[model samples]
Target: MIYFSLQTPSIPTLEETQAVVQEVHQDLQQLKPNAILETIRSWTPGLLSFSYRLLYAAIIIIIGNRIAFYLRRFLKRTFDRMGMDLGLSKFLISLANAIAYAIVIFMALEKIGIPSTSIIALLGSATLAIGLSLQESLGNFAGGILILVMRPFGIHDYIVSEGVEGKVLNIGLVYTTLLTVDNRRITIPNGTLSNAVITNVTAQEKRRIDLTIGISYSSDLKKAKAILERIYREDPQILQDEPITVYVDQLADSSVILGSRGWAATEDYWAARWRIIEKTKLEFDDAGIEIPYNQMDVNIFQKTIDK
Candidate 1:
């Protein structure tokens, strides 16, 4: 019979494991510096190229912005030379400036590795989204275009619309600015202004001034009429070619109303009206004419009750 011996494999000792760990740690320490250097060496060219592109884009933006500003100034001068309508000129200038800036942005983007066609596609999508979200703004833009085409009013034209009366300061892409009589600035949407009933106050070269002056019944009606006619004739601002009439407008309870009508240069309407009214008061005073005031006379009688 053959005898077989079973032998178990010997496991590694703790010292042996510790030695292997030390060898691996030393090898990693020796490779660390070279690995870092290799990484930097590999990335340097790409980093430099990206940095150059970034700097070039920045330069493009700066130079392009300056060019856009100068272009706008040139356009403004050209429009002024052409005697273009102030509102239309301003609007066109704004549009051109916007286009120039857009071109600059696209060029800068291309330098930064973004394609212009891609940008245009992105803008198309964005515009569609914005158009749906901003319908009112789009309406205002359309209205502005209509205003430019229709020529109903212009910059510096005094207009009254929707209870707002003022001199138009600007007609912009979406808003129309007005400077009020009291020097308040008002901004109204172009859409609203376009749809509203606008009264062009200064459109005509001449305007008629109608004044109603009331005198007491005791005062001479013919004398009051004569005074009004004389005031209209004497005023240099009033137009002599236009018909000037003073008539008995109404007979009220305590006074007779005299209606006076005169025509004057549109620009001089207020001055003529004020001057004539002042002269009428002075003339009536000298002629002993009385302007009636609203007065109430109350009479009370005492009644005694006896029980």
Candidate 2:
């Protein structure tokens, strides 16, 4: 007689495997109540641990945010009290706020057991990319800051930069706005303006008017100079300390150049310049001085037909 074994095989046949799985599933379903209790007994402590950590991280973040906010406000107030430029103060405050928040974020992550070194590295890479992409913007920002600190020009100050001559209307973070004499509004990038030669016409309390007049070489230089000097002296608006200079500047191909220079208040610069030009022209006409122009004598070199 053969004896049948009661123990199950470790690797069952296909049908046996399916049947055993179905039976085990049914048994597990029957034990669900006890199984859930056992699972809860095991997971209660871990869940509580996770919850406490999350709560701690949240509290840290809240405190950090508050601290950062207060610090930014304090810095802004201090700068304002010190009479710093409003635009610059606001920019500094924004930058400080961003930095403070970034530090707080990193600290919060670190408190939660996240390795901050990787996060910092990742942020550094991102910052580098952003910086490279915004190089021109960064340059403009730097230029604006330099202008604000150095005070190369001020509002309503006349200046010539990057081929634009106008009165400064506003200095922004990325550009400077100007109102041209012809009433045109122009915007110039601060980076380009900072790099080029800046002629600040209103930096000084007094500015000199530069007037040039061309006269025929045959005209009497002494007479022209005397006439120019008299016009300057007769003008009550001209400053007394600043001498009116009238001298021959150069001998061009067609004419003699007379340079007239006189100092006046910066505000009166344009008025003085216009007045000098008008008066000089009138005086020259009255004195019968010839204002010469460029003349050209062209001789055609032609081949003559052989006779």
Candidate 3:
């Protein structure tokens, strides 16, 4: 037979237990301030580095903006000296300014710890998305470039396209502004404008004025032609170097149509035409020439009572 021996564990008194707890609490209280100081010391360098970076970023932005402004001013002066087309010069200046600002922004971002490569990748993605979504706008931008290169029309040119007639106010990247004769502003997409039939009224140095005058068949054709030729010769705006032609154009049922053609300076075209028409009317009346009009004669007979 085997036997085992055991002993009961000793239990501490209540006063002893309370004294131990008090001792531990006092030890923790003594270490708390040291722990707090250690934590602050560990974070100090990182915090200071972040603060310096933020301040540097701010300075970069400020300096970069100033440089961009000066650069834009310089470009404007250079373009003025070169006598560049207004539309093309404006477009190029704006494009340069945008590029400068983009560079400045990327520099600021890099100072704040953002990588330029990452930014470029993000921009690439964004540009692809935008290009897909704004295809028409991109087309308009391309059209603007074409307009600047080909030079179909220029600033202040009076043009008629897509049924809209106006003076070109500005040609931007995506839209071309027009100021109508009535002082209304119209904005047209450059893409549409580039594709349409553009009639530049003031493109030439001189324009022709063609007028058709109708007189009674009984009127003397020779006299009408002679009067028209004389009027063309007397008009100061009509260019004497150009050929003037007046002839009988058509013979209708009740009237003979006389056609007159004369050349005038582009700027004087409207005034010259108006003056010629007014003088022709006055002179024709004075010469006893009858301008025919349609007239219907009504006859009522005894047949109406029979009906």
What TM-score does each of the candidates earn?
A: 0.61, 0.67, 0.64
Summing lDDT over every window of 10 consecutive residues in candidate 1, give the lowest-scoring window: 82-91
Shift of residue 33 alpha carbon in model 1, Å = 48
RMSD of 3: 7.9
Ranking by TM-score: 2, 3, 1
The pairs that clash in candidate 2 are none
Candidate 2 structure quality by residue, lDDT tens digits, 1-307: 9999899668778998899999999999889988899999999998888778778889988998899889988998799788777888888889898888888788777777788899999989998999999999999989998887677888888998767899999999889999999999999888888778999988898987778888998999899989888888877668978888888899898888988888888888778878878888888898999898767899999898998
The whole-model lDDT of each prediction reads: 0.92, 0.87, 0.91
- Stretches off by above 4 angstroms in model 2 are 1-70, 81-83, 129-142, 145-151, 214-222, 248-257, 289-307
Write out the backbone clash pairs for model 3.
none
1-307: candidate 3 lDDT, tens digit per residue: 9999898888999999999999999999989988999999999999999999999999998999999899989989998998777767888889898999899889988999999889899999999999999998999999988887678888888899978999999988689999998999999999999999999988999999999989998888889889889999999999999999998899888899999999999989989999999999998998888899999999977654554
- After superposing candidate 3 on the true structure, give the runs of residues whose Cα lies further than 4 Å from its correct spot: 1-84, 90-122, 304-307
Q: Model 1: runs farther than 4 Å from truth?
A: 1-127, 305-307
Worst 10 residues of 3 by lDDT: 298-307
Error of 3 at 141 (Å): 2.1
